[model samples]
Target: MSATGVQQVVAEMLQPYLDQEGFELVDVEYVKEGGNRYLRVYVDKEGGIDIDECGRISEYLSDRLDDKDPIPDAYILEVSSPGAERPLKKPEDFRRAVGKDVYITTYEPIGGKKEFEGRLLSYDENELTLNSGKKTDVIPTDKVAGARLAIIF
Candidate 1:
């Protein structure tokens, strides 16, 4: 299967277990580096995820993936926390980051620039308002190439 397909399948497979354990699925990535392929799963919770919990979750997911055999090639599987700079992929992620600092990059320049780093004031379906203290920028959601939690302001 394709990398995207592997990610989707793994997400679906782990959804029930994650929901039951109060763990949030942060993101899944299937990629190749050098000559080795990797399947990485990033997970978190309300109070943050611990190393032991990550091990348990990894073991559980490892078993599930072994059973399913969804991937065509051999690869390493890793499950862990998203760390301090968590990615903002889902709508809920964006909404939760409304009052936090963020680093957002647009596919193209929005206002003669492509990068915006500041406090997120608000987020809606169409756009998000960010205040850099110097100025406030309203960035369209569709233009975002990448978004992540930035250092607290």
Candidate 2:
């Protein structure tokens, strides 16, 4: 099957288990890098996730994949936490991220540039308010190409 199809299938198969286990499904990614294919599943919970948790999820998923035989090719399976810099794909993610540091890239320039990194003040379906140092930028949600939680050093 196609890569997107594989992602959908795996996500469908994993959701029930995750929900029952008190885990949240963050995202599923299928990609080819360094001449190898990888299916990466990002998961999280109320506090966070640890290596042992990832291993347990991985072990369970490995068995399911073996039974379903969904991929149709040789690929490595990786399950882990999304980390502190988790991508904000849904509107809910943006909404929950208010008052947190975030890095955002727009499809086109918002204020003479495409990148904005600062504190997210507020978020709604129409737009999001951000404060970057001395400036506050109001960004249209539709214009965002990518967004992620950021750790400022």
Candidate 3:
């Protein structure tokens, strides 16, 4: 199956289990690294996710995947937490990230720049307020091509 198709199938199959366990499905990746194919599921919760939680989720999904046999070829199935620098793929992610450092990229220039890395001051339905050094930048949410938690030192 295609990479996107694989991710979708895995997400659909595992979402119910994750929800029941108070886990959030952050992202799913099906990629080729060197000669091997890998299927990785990134999960998270309020405080964070631990190794034991990841193991349980992995086992549950493994059983389900084995029963359904969704993938035609061999691949690795991994379940783990989305770490500190997790991608903010949804509005809720941005909301949770308020008062935290972030790195965001836009599809096109906003205020003559496509990149914004700073403290995410706030997030409304339509926009985000970022304190980028000495200046504050207001960026439209729709223009964001990518966003992730960042560490600035």
Worst 10 residues of 3 by lDDT: 73-82
Model 1 misplaced stretches (Cα beyond 4 Å): none
Quote each prediction's TM-score.
0.97, 0.96, 0.93
Tens digit of lDDT per residue, candidate 3, span 81-113? 889899999889999999999999999999899
What digit string (tens of lDDT, one per residue) describes model 2 on residues 35-65?
Answer: 8999999999989999999999999899999
Estimate the TM-score for candidate 2: 0.96
- Looking at model 1, report the run of 10 residues with the lowest lDDT sum: 144-153
Our model 1 lands, by Cα RMSD against the true structure, at 0.9
Tens-digit lDDT track for model 1 on 72-104? 899999999999989999999999999999999
How many steric clashes between backbone atoms does each model show? 0, 0, 0
- Please identify which of the two predictions, 1 or 2, would achieve the higher lDDT against the true structure: 1
Which regions in candidate 3 have their CA more than 4 angstroms from the true location?
none
Q: Rank the candidates by TM-score, best first.
A: 1, 2, 3
* Deviation from native of the Cα of residue 2 in model 3, angstroms: 2.1
